[model samples]
Target: MKNFILALIVGLLVSACSIQRSAITGDKRAYGYSWEQEKQIGKEADEQIKQHFGVYDNVALQQYVNKIGQEMLAVSHMQREDTPATYKDTEFFFRLLDSPVVNAFALPGGYIYVTRGLLSHLDNEAQLAVVLGHEIGHVAARHASQRAFIQQMSQIALVGGAIAGQHFLGIPGGDLLGIGGMAAQVIFLSYSREDERESDRLGVEYASMQRYKSAEGAQFFVSLERMSAQSGQSIPNWQSTHPDPAERATSIPELAEEWRAIGYEQTIVNTDQYMGMLNNMIYGDNPREGFTRSGTYYHPEMKFQFSYPEGWHVINQRSLVAVVNNDQNAVSIMTLDNESAGAEASVNVFLNQDGITTTGKSGITNRGLQAFQAEATGQTQDGVALKFYLYSIEYDGMIYRFINYTTVDNYGTYGPRFKEITSGFRQLTDSGILNIQPVRLQAVKTTRSGTFRSFLPANLENLVINVTPEDIAIMNQVGLDERIESGTWIKIPR
Candidate 1:
């Protein structure tokens, strides 16, 4: 019995040691996720990510970005011969997410993502390399695993309050926690400020080692700062999960100078190559998925239209579309349920859910669409009381559900608005709205020297890209008053 007890203790110690040493940064006090476990976690999270935000649908651009990412990874920390076999064997995936939100991030086990929004903002290839390297650094340093371990150790319950915290942190699945449950939020958890700083450091190191002019990466941060200021946001959504852009812009150039001091003379900054790649890139939101115009939500592919409450905020995610009142005391969500054969079946499913108390008669909507409406009260898993008006309508061969909910106390005030929106749903038949294309960036050469604003075409705002001279200045990495030399190439939205 004594010998068996000793053996058990020895095995436990070995396991703990393995977990500590698994960190790619060689920190023995790091998290408990083994390389294999990290990979598994990333794999599962990657699927959820793909489901929530699809891959950007450009094959050639995807390949081009992947080629650059592959080159960077070959020189990253994980690619070293001294890296642990488990970690070294893990394959890194670079994906361009189809989101208009400018952002770049990574998941555990070598999964890295950059949004097309982020790509469109980049000024040069070296900046792109630095961004990719920063995300890779997060994966290599086991930051997400560390965060998961911290969450586990802290036993942070991902309830409504926690979901709100995640939302304010700018991670995905903020409002989605209530819709799809907590699984979606888990995969998109944010990193700590320290983790972001370390990744930034790693980014400079890796990009500089690859002989890229890493200082050019600072221009992206400048754009971020300008964007935040323009939006009147104290911190941009992307920076909420990462670090302060102003701080990053200040420090990145200094870090680049240090890297250059190591005797690397021929650093490459392929600005023309990068700008040419982004010449026709989509600038802002893609209307193909869904878009709002004159307070109405239109889905071109789904061929449906609905009016949301005026002044309400809307979040259009891939999995769902949601609108919440300015007070945030009420929310209206739209989703599809293909499994339900008809409207009555969809209503029945909602009524059958646990804790739901159906309080009104369910019947057809006023428009003669196969539909039913029900007033229901329910409690979330956290036991928060909720009042809901659920509308299930069968439209275009699918069951479309409109769930409007509020706290029990606020239901009376929000009920009329909810009813108005739910009743406003109908099939769309407008060809012009359906065929509208997204705004794209057009690279044009300067005909004569002038201020940046002078080069902008008169109908810039009327086009899909709604931006100002200040925005154009930031994109071109020049001042608004800076004179443009003749024949200089610049990007203008068209």
Candidate 2:
């Protein structure tokens, strides 16, 4: 018994020693995940991420982001001389998400993602490097591992394993509470404030080492501030998932100055080069995928058309589309049903799910498509009573389903609108609409000096998708009336 106790004590000591302090934060942590476990989790989450948000689908752009990321990663603590051999061999992946949401995040084991929405706002390559470097810092400092350790201590599931399955793992089938579905949200949970700050400092450090003008990165925060104000958000996103934009604007410049004082004087802006790359890039939402015009939603590739209730907000995600009412009281989501069965069978499968009670028989659509419509009642996870209006339609060999819901009391007011939208589905046969290409940012040079607004097209609203002269001004980092020098290049969507 004495010998066995001695052996156990030695094993525990070895295990404890394996948990090392962070190189950047100096925080001692006994990470819940082994190096292999961390890699495995990230790999699994990465697969789901690709299915959810999709890869951006531009090879040159992908290569450009990876090139900058790998350069910064070489200088990060993950590749430092003192880094453990176990960590040194870990490969880092930098992916550009096709999403238009202005967001960036890192997964536990060296996977980083940035949305095109965030990329479009950046003025130069230096800013992009800083953003990539910040994500790299998260991996280098092992923030996710530390968070996982705390989650384990609290006995809270990091993310339930059941979330890996279909049917949104338990979320009501039609809600947009978790956009890009729930699995994407699991990998993108906000980082701690301290972790964000540490990553900020590391971002500045890595960008400076690369001879980039790190202060240029702070300008992106100005855009974020403008976006928050315009959207009427109570708190800016930076404050929630990242350090406050105002705070970062101050700190990043200060760090950049310090790096300059240390003799790294070749701070390159490379503005023109970056602007050249932005030429012909998709400026905002890619309307080719799906877009709403005059209360109608059109998917060019799918060649389908539908209409939602007037004045409702439309959220088009990679996997599904959601139409939400003004009062946040009702949501109607359209998504593809995985089952290959006919419309009636698909509706039967959905209604048969646990906790949902069907109240009516399925009916066919009068618009030529074979459709199944049913009314049902179900309770939310919070036990709130909800009235559901579901429709499954057969279109082009695929089963498309709409799950529309509202409170039991409000269903009468919302039901007709739901019925209108579900019945509105039809094959889109408009050639001009079908061939509508997404607006691409075209580089143009001024023939003569004038205010930035002078160069804008007369029918700017028609040319661009939901863009204004003011938006173009902000995108170019100038005032709308700011005078442009002759021969200077600027970007405009075409």
- Model 2 accuracy (lDDT, Cα): 0.78
Q: Give the TM-score of candidate 1.
A: 0.88
Q: Quote each prediction's TM-score.
A: 0.88, 0.85
Candidate 2 segments exceeding 4 Å error: 1-20, 23-27, 32-35, 148-185, 234-236, 363-366, 445-449, 486-489
Give one digit per residue, the lDDT tens place, for model 2 in 82-197: 87777789999999988766778788778999887677778788999999999898888777777766655554544433221323314533234333332443453447999888
RMSD of each: 4.9, 5.9
- The number of clashing residue pairs in model 2 is 0
Q: Pairs clashing in candidate 1?
A: none
Q: What range of 10 consecutive residues in model 1 has the weakest lDDT sum?
A: 163-172
lDDT string, candidate 1, 190-256, tens digits: 7788988988888988888889988888888888888788778744336566688888998888888
